[model samples]
Target: MNLLYKSSDESATSYICDETGYYLIRLQSKVSEQNYKAAYSAVLESAKTKPYQKIILSVIDDDENPLSVPFSARSWFASYFSPQFYKLAQNQVDVGIVKPKTKLQTNMMHVILGVVEKTNIKINAAYFDKEEEAKEWMKCPT
Candidate 1:
């Protein structure tokens, strides 16, 4: 597995990519609407070349804040790709792994997962736990 790291002003600390069709995104701060959009854009742009089979987003929320309106609404209207880049990827990508740090927040997780499910995205799996688990999941075959 070949992993590369990139930095963004958003919550994410690094973006890891492997030639085997998987991406692991590690978040370092609380996720905000603006940050989410930026991260999504970065990931989407990267995906154009890598064409990952799965994307594991490791969200670490030390504050456990409620989902922002834009993010929630984007999840709600996820069917249309015009709003969120993540949703756009969901339409074509093979899998989406959303991992929340510590004990997962059910509502936020559900919202994202529901959007993925509703969109009929081929999610190999989803998880919420330590960063290691997320990384391992991203490496594993679907």
Candidate 2:
């Protein structure tokens, strides 16, 4: 993977390339709401330049803490009803991938997959017991 951008704090890393089609963002730490927003913005900016077909996010919880209640709620809402982002993703690129590790990670993954299934979005996804497997899956074809 071609490293397009690396966060100064080392909390996250992003890669972009023509072969991949979209920016691949992998968070190496337990991302806070602020961090999430910043990552989103960064991905958006990269999208403008790279013009990828989709975004594949691979996030893992560095602390192994359960998804915060607020984060889970927000993610569920966004996955189901975020019309603006969904529309923006419609033609530009699709967003898909595994959720960060949390107590509710499995449930959240199910919810996300259900949303993608219902919406007819071509989101390829999987769960990994290890980050290496997740990375390999991300690089492999659906």
Candidate 3:
């Protein structure tokens, strides 16, 4: 896979293997609400340029993600993730979230997923505790 973009703060990075349709996103130790948008946007931007837009997002977050999401940020987050997920979910894409351990982010992620499910959102996504398991689900390259 070739690196497509790296954030200036080193909080997020993206890579794509054009030949295989595998897109990898690596989130560093600390991730803010904006970082999530940045990472997802990076994937979407890369997808726009690809010939076929069937992307497999292999999101690796070691489960120890020190997510800095203050309560005041919740409203903005709801607005952000919903539309973002809607656009991606409408496409032929797969999302794999890899969390190696349980952390504050895990519960938050579950809350997000729960809302998506309860609202009957159509997103092909799942959370895995291992990178290999997540990769297997997304058909990510080894």
The residue pairs found clashing in candidate 1 are none
Ten contiguous residues with the weakest lDDT in model 1:
76-85
lDDT of model number 1: 0.52
Q: What is the lDDT of residue 54 in candidate 2?
A: 57
| Candidate order, TM-score descending | 3, 1, 2
Cα RMSD, model 2: 4.4
lDDT of each: 0.52, 0.55, 0.57
Clashing pairs in 3: none
Q: Which stretches of candidate 2 lie above 4 Å from their native place?
A: 1-9, 62-73, 76-103, 113-122, 126-142
1-142: candidate 3 lDDT, tens digit per residue = 7876676777766777665566677665555657656665666666545633333433344434554444433444345544454564454445566753446666766776676556555556666666566546555422
Best candidate according to TM-score: 3
Q: List candidate 1 segments past 4 Å from native.
A: 1-10, 28-30, 63-98, 101-104
Q: How would you encode candidate 1's per-residue C-alpha lDDT over 94-127 as one tens digit per residue?
A: 3444554444444666666676576555555555
TM-score of each: 0.64, 0.58, 0.64
